[model samples]
Target chain A: MELYDLELSGNCYKVRLLAALAGIDLTLKPVDFLAGDHKRSPVIDLNPWGELPVLVDGGTVLRDSQAILVYLASAYAGHAWWPDAPAAQGDVMQWLSVASNEIHYGPNSARLVDKFGYDLDKATTLQISERILGLIDQHLQSNEWLAMGRPTIAECAVYPYIAVAGEGGIDLTPYQNINQWMARIKALPGYISMPGVA
Target chain B: MELYDLELSGNCYKVRLLAALAGIDLTLKPVDFLAGDHKRSPVIDLNPWGELPVLVDGGTVLRDSQAILVYLASAYAGHAWWPDAPAAQGDVMQWLSVASNEIHYGPNSARLVDKFGYDLDKATTLQISERILGLIDQHLQSNEWLAMGRPTIAECAVYPYIAVAGEGGIDLTPYQNINQWMARIKALPGYISMPGVA
Candidate 1:
């Protein structure tokens, strides 16, 4: 299997982290994102979205970090990472949606503005970050993991952005529950750390 | 089962449509979105995100339209709407992420700006809408369905926003392929239509 990756992208990092945790060997093909390599041929051919973190396994090519997480969990990590029950899967799927929507627009967008010079509304991104972080903290007040009471793809999906939120000017100090959750994720077996996370 | 829904929301509509097609009984509990019902107690208690299309089934309460779609398909739709195979499920999930991210921020955001007076960048939303719609059209040129070559959750996830893109000031006339895809979805057995789709 091969993964088209960008070192700085949390989305790409999540895929790498999950693959490592699952004991899956993935040949990391680094893309020149700054040079617009992802927007051109080969990468664009692999994923029409022209997004990084495209996973190619044999004949199957998958895009989107959340989707890739689902594929990895289902194919490699087994039920421990992603459950088989409908409701249990839904529990994880809810956070995946949050990862794609709230997390992407919130901390991810804020990071893009601060670290990558993307023209986006920082105030709105910060507001979204605060709201989602607060909600996750509250949810984590009683629960250990995001869903299924175990380390599912939900944790992997939402982990990177919240862990590296400080780079986006969204402080994580106020979110104590979230802080502990991040710690628990880091303590997981075979955990791999990204540049901004630790 | 009960669905907390707002009739006009494409997200909510997708859940209802899926249930209708799957022969699952859903008692629609209409939330007064204009009255800020979704932002308040019961709705917020059900889903911290406070978004509509919350599904309550016996002991399980699920939020996010995409997540609810997964739950419904897994529990009731018999793998027709959402397959169990890893690659196929991932294929469907890729579009679900698109539905949540690109579709939400693109045509959906544009609709919010035009139809509900949301303060958003109209130009960016239009650009995103055109890009995603064009990509979908190209992908559909060779394949009948978005994924798995059948009516999967991928179609259900993306159907609403593109079908109602005109409400967002995004004209769908140029994309003949997308128009045919929309028509194909409408022609599906047991398919249901929401407002502005026809």
Candidate 2:
């Protein structure tokens, strides 16, 4: 199995982090966004969207970070991280959807823009991030993880961008419960810090 | 179970569509955004974000339409609509995430702006809807359903919005495959249309 990875991507980080936690060995094949590798024809042939952290196993290819997380959890483990329970599964999916839509759109994009200079509305993005973070913080007030009382795919997808969001000029000190949850996720066994872009 | 619903909301429509298809009995509790219901203290006390279609089953309340889909499928049908196969699960999630993030953000929001008279950048919203419809056409080319090889949660969550997107002034003439897929899903047993807003 091969993972087409980007060191700075939170979604890609999701695949790498889960792989580390679940003990799945995959050759990390770096796709150079600096060289516009994902935008090139060859990579576009694999995924038309030209997105990063694509996973290729045997003859199959998968794109999108949340999709890759599901693939990793389902293919590698015995449904522990993904969970098979319906109500629990719903809770898990809710968190993943929030990560994909709100957090990624707001905080993740804001962080990227602050560091990398992507064109996005700054004030609105910050406001969006604040609302989402507040929701997460409220959820974490009693729950140990993001969803279903277990550290499921939701945490895997949402944690990275959120943990590093302060670097985007957004303050995290206000979100006490979320801060504690971030610490808890970081302290988990087999935890790997996201690769920093120098 | 009580569903905090808004008839005009595609997100709310998804929960209703799934509950009908799966035979899950739910009471639809209306929340009027125009009436400033969500901004008031009571609904926010349940969901601080004040989003619609919150599924309250016993003491557990689940938000997010995609989350609700997975929850209904899990609680009622186990892993049937969500699927359990790793590679298949990846397919299911990819479409599910797209429904929540892309379809909802693109076409759904565009429709809202045009039909609901919400202030927005009309040109950008139209462009986004076109891009999403194009992507949906591409996906429907080889697959019969939106996610996986079967009628998974992806189709259930997105079909309503995509089908009625024309109401929001998005021309559907270009998306032949999508039109065909929508027809096929409706032809399925237990399929139910959302209640008319009039």
Candidate 3:
């Protein structure tokens, strides 16, 4: 399997994190995101959205990190990371939506602005970050993991952006439960680190 | 099964559309969105996010329309709506993320601003809408359905917003393929309509 990735992107790191945890071997095809390489050939050819973390496994090509997680976990990993049950898939999916929507707009966008100098509303990103972080913190207060009562791809989908929220100039100090959850994820065997994620 | 719904919400309509198409029975528990009922006890108790289209199925409670569609299709609707294979699930999931992220921030947010008078960046919403709409149109140009080579929950997840894009002040006239795709979805068995869609 070939993964067209960006070293600093939380989205890309999330996929890599899942692969490492699930023991799935992948050849990392690092894209030169800083040089507008993602918008050009090979990458753009695979994904018209011109996004990083495009996975090409045999004949299957997928974009979007959440979708890639679904593919990788289901195909290569096993049911533990991506379950077969409908309700369980739905349970894991809620956080996948969170990762795709809230985390993307909140901490991810904030990092894009602060780290990559992308033109985005910093205040709005911070506001969104605070709201979503609060919700996740509260959710974590009662649950040991994000979903399925055990480690699943939900952790893989959500943990990267949060681990690197400091790069976005967003503070994670107040989110105690979230902090503990991050520690739990870090302590997991086969967990790997990327540029921004510790 | 119960759905905490709002008649005018595309998110809610997506779930209803899936139920109708899949023959899944749901007791409509319409929330008075205008009166801020969604933020109150019952709705908020089920989904702390205070979002519309919350589903409660006995032991299972799911929020996010995309997640609900996953549950309904996988549990009751069968493999035709939501497939069993990994690559197929990933294929369907690509658009699910679109429904959750791009569609939510794009046309959905635009509608929120224009129709519901929410204080959101209309310009940004339109920009996001244009980009995503163009991408979907382009994808539809080559493919018949969004995924799995036939109608699936992707249509339910995507159609409602595009059907009512006019309410968001988004002109869909340029996207001929999207219009055609919408027509096909409407022609599906057990198709239902919401306000501003027709």
Candidate 4:
């Protein structure tokens, strides 16, 4: 299997992180997102939306980070990351939605815009970040992971952007549980830090 | 099983529609979003994010429309709406994410701000709607369902918002394939219409 990826990108980093965790050896093919390479034909064939972190595994092309994580977990992992129980599954999935829909697109995107020196709606970004971080902090208080009682898909997908959310100008000091959770994630064996960060 | 939902809400409607199709009978409890009732105690217990379409199967309170759909399909269905094939499953999940993050949060939210007389960042909403609608239309032209050659989780979760996106102030008439897709989805037996429509 080959993963079309960009190293600096947190979204691309998600697939790479998951692959490493699940012991899925993937042929990594870097895509030049900055040069409008993802918008071209063959790349578009893999991702019609022409986005990064596209996974190609013989007769299959998959885009979107959360989707890729789900596939990898469902296909390869040994029953630890994805909790198959009914309510527990729902709980894990809810956080994944928050990661992809609320947090990542909110503070993560805002921070990216800041890092890249692009204009962002500052007020909205701050509001989104503050609220999302608050909800996460609240969740982390009673639970070891994003999902209660288990480190499921929720933690796998959401923890990274949250750990780096401070880079987007949102302070994480107030969220003690989140800080602790971040440390726990880093301690996992085979954990690789995202590219370009010391 | 009971579903806490609102009649006119696209997210809430998704839960109802899928349950009906999947042959699961849910006791419907209407949650009044207009009254700010969702933020209150028990409702908050249902979903900390305070969103609509919370499904309670006895003790299990499932939030996030897509998450609820996954639970329903995985738990109750005799057959698969969420295909087991990893690659196709990824594709199914990708569009479901698109429905929540982009389609509902973008165009659907934009249209609601219009109806509720809430302030909106118009330029951003327009940009988001155009991108989402164009992609959905193109996908529809080539694939009969958003699931891509199968009626998977993606279709059950996403079809409602896209079908009514024009009500969100998107001109769906321009996307001929989307128009056709709407007719097909509507033609499905047990199909239900969202509020403010015939």
Shift in Å, residue B105, candidate 4:
2.9
lDDT string, candidate 2, B135-164, tens digits: 789978997887667787778877878877
What is candidate 4's CAPRI-style docking category based on DockQ? Answer: medium
Q: Label model 3 with its docking quality class.
A: high
Over B131-160, each residue of candidate 1 has an lDDT whose tens digit, in order, gives 999999999999988999888888889989
RMSD of each: 1.2, 2.4, 0.8, 1.7
How well is each residue in A60-117 modelled by candidate 1, as lDDT tens digits? Answer: 9999998898898899977888898999999999999999999999999999999999
Expressed as tens digits, the lDDT of each residue in B1-198 for candidate 3 is 999999998999999999999899999998998899999998899899989889999999999999999999999977999998999999999999999899999999999999989998899999999999999999999998999889999999988999999999999999999989888888888989998985
Ranking by DockQ: 3, 1, 2, 4
Worst 10 residues of 3 chain A by lDDT: A189-198
Which pairs in model 1 have colliding backbones? none
lDDT of 2 by residue, A1-198 (tens): 999888888888888888888888989988889899998866787777788878899977898889888888878877878887677767788878887788877888898889889776677679779889888888789889887777877888999888778767788889999888888888888888875411
> What fraction of the native interface does candidate 4 get right in terms of contacts?
0.64
Best by lDDT: 3
Name the top TM-score candidate. 3
Report the lDDT tens digits of candidate 4 across residue range B87-160. 66677889878876787667777777776666768667778889888888888887887876766667767777
Highest DockQ: give the candidate number: 3
What fraction of native interface contacts is shared by candidate 1?
0.81
Query: What's the i-RMS of each model?
Result: 0.7, 1.3, 0.6, 1.4
Q: Worst ten-residue run, lDDT, model 4 chain B?
A: B78-87
Task: Please list the residue runs of candidate 2 whose C-alpha ends up more than 4 Å from where it truly belongs after superposition.
Answer: A195-198, B40-42, B78-80, B195-198
- Model 3 per-residue lDDT at B17: 96
